[model samples]
Target chain A: MKRIFTPAFLLLTAQSFAQDIKPEMADSFRSSGKIYVVVCVAAIVLTGLLVYLITIDRKVSKLERDLKSLDKTSN
Target chain B: MNIKKNWWKAITCVLLFYTVIEGFLGAVPARDILNETIRNLYFHVPMWFGMMTLLFISVIYGIKHLHNGAMRSDLIAREAAHTGVIMGVLGLITGSLWARYTWGTWWTQDTKLNGAAITMLIYFAYFILRGSVEDEQKRARLSAVYSIFAFVMMIVFVMILPRMEDSLHPGNGGNPAFSKYDLDSKMRLVFYPAVLGWVLLGVWIMSVRIRIASISEALLNHSDTHPTS
Candidate 1:
């Protein structure tokens, strides 16, 4: 009985160890709070691109206005 | 820059800013084979959505051109297609990078990936078709017809075909979509807004391209009218 119990106990412990192996994630990075750095960098790049797009949009609007005036003057 | 006129652009900025911040910081289900890369859903999926939306707009403009024979409509269709292709290419590259780490291959013969590549090639051919034609009216008419065909083909390749067969991509084949498992309520908070933001950004870019095209067309006409100037 004692011998049988020992092996059963071993199997239970092995199963518990297996269950402990959870899927790995960036827990350490999050815990360290350095993930904000990445978030900030991405936000900055997106902001820059959006700003550039706005400038292009404004330039196009100006060009259209100028073209309209030019057409009026020529007519 | 007018708040009332460009409210959507403001929404685009706000939604994207929220997505960027929440996407990284948000809690996600830990699953094997995906792990942290699952966060890519917010970024990668939105590209495809944006492409689809832009392409749909392109086809609508193509139809408008066909009906009215308007050069402006043709220009809008062309520029929208151009922007859609850009978004599709970005989607492909980002998907490839994500696959490299998770799927263990940079390129696979998967149905979805191959379908996307084929769709992009078809659009590239659309541009070539336009370039090959020398006459303006002829080019507009021909490309408008071709854009309709191309848009249909895109739908087939990217949408229909992928679902008809087994694909490595989620939501295809026998595999369940991320929404069924990993894309929990938390991710949805970011995912839906990300889709909206990216689609808006694509439209903004397409609008800019269309404006630029209009300016060029106007300049050409002006030069033709006054050759000395």
Candidate 2:
């Protein structure tokens, strides 16, 4: 009887401890569906930056073309 | 830009858009201390990957310059290194922000952190060494040799040393990398593409810098030959 009681008591305590301690996460924020707002903001910023980079790339290509023409005329 | 030639830039745009959206919406393994900030893995880790790729390109150009004695190779090497430094700075800042929320401090004496700092300083010295040389040929020769040496040192500090000792950063010291256990299959779907996208972005910036440098050099030569214009 004593041996059985000791093991049972330990198991009960362990189960309670496991249930009491859980890692914290932003489940509430996610459940509310506001994560889409964050995602959209990030996407917009990235798109804006990429557009600027494309313009710079086009300008460089124009410069290269002009230089090639100048070389042909000079030669 | 030609569609065939510039397809990779379009891919970059698509991959990044996917990353930003999927990264936030995707499910992650629940773990203590990390929580929501575990999402940073998608953004922060990619910066280091991009930096390493740019620096590796720099080393390749350095070797090419030595082999062919081409100033064009030297220009590429310099621009690659510049872009690499920019990526590294971004990596450091993002890592610090992640650490502050997760590690409870803005800075710590972690092995990987210090290794990254030392590597940055070594590259900084490489730049300073280049600036001090007056002769272009001599400067190119000296810096090419130094770039090779610096790349080796970077591999040592950022990769090898961190693994040999105890480090707070994962994948170092005996700690398993995030991929081994923490990064589930769902997270990997975003992570790999994020690495590729960020690395491609670094290459794009480096290429732009190289083009600008070449244009300026050509303009300078044109002015020298025809002062009337």
lDDT of 1 by residue, B1-229 (tens): 6788889988989998998988887767778999989989999999999999998999899899889998898899889999999999999999999999999999999989999999999999999999999998899899888888998998899888989998889988787777675448888888899899999999999998998998999999999998877
Query: Candidate 1, residue B51: CA error in Å?
Result: 0.8
TM-score of the second chain for every model = 0.97, 0.97
lDDT digits (tens) for residues B1-229 of candidate 2: 7999999999999999988988987767767898878889889999999989999999999999999999999999999999999999999999999999989988899889999998899999989999999999899999999999999999999999999998889899887677663458888998999889988999998999999999999998998998887
Angstrom error of the Cα, residue A29, model 1: value is 0.8
Flag clash pairs in model 2: none
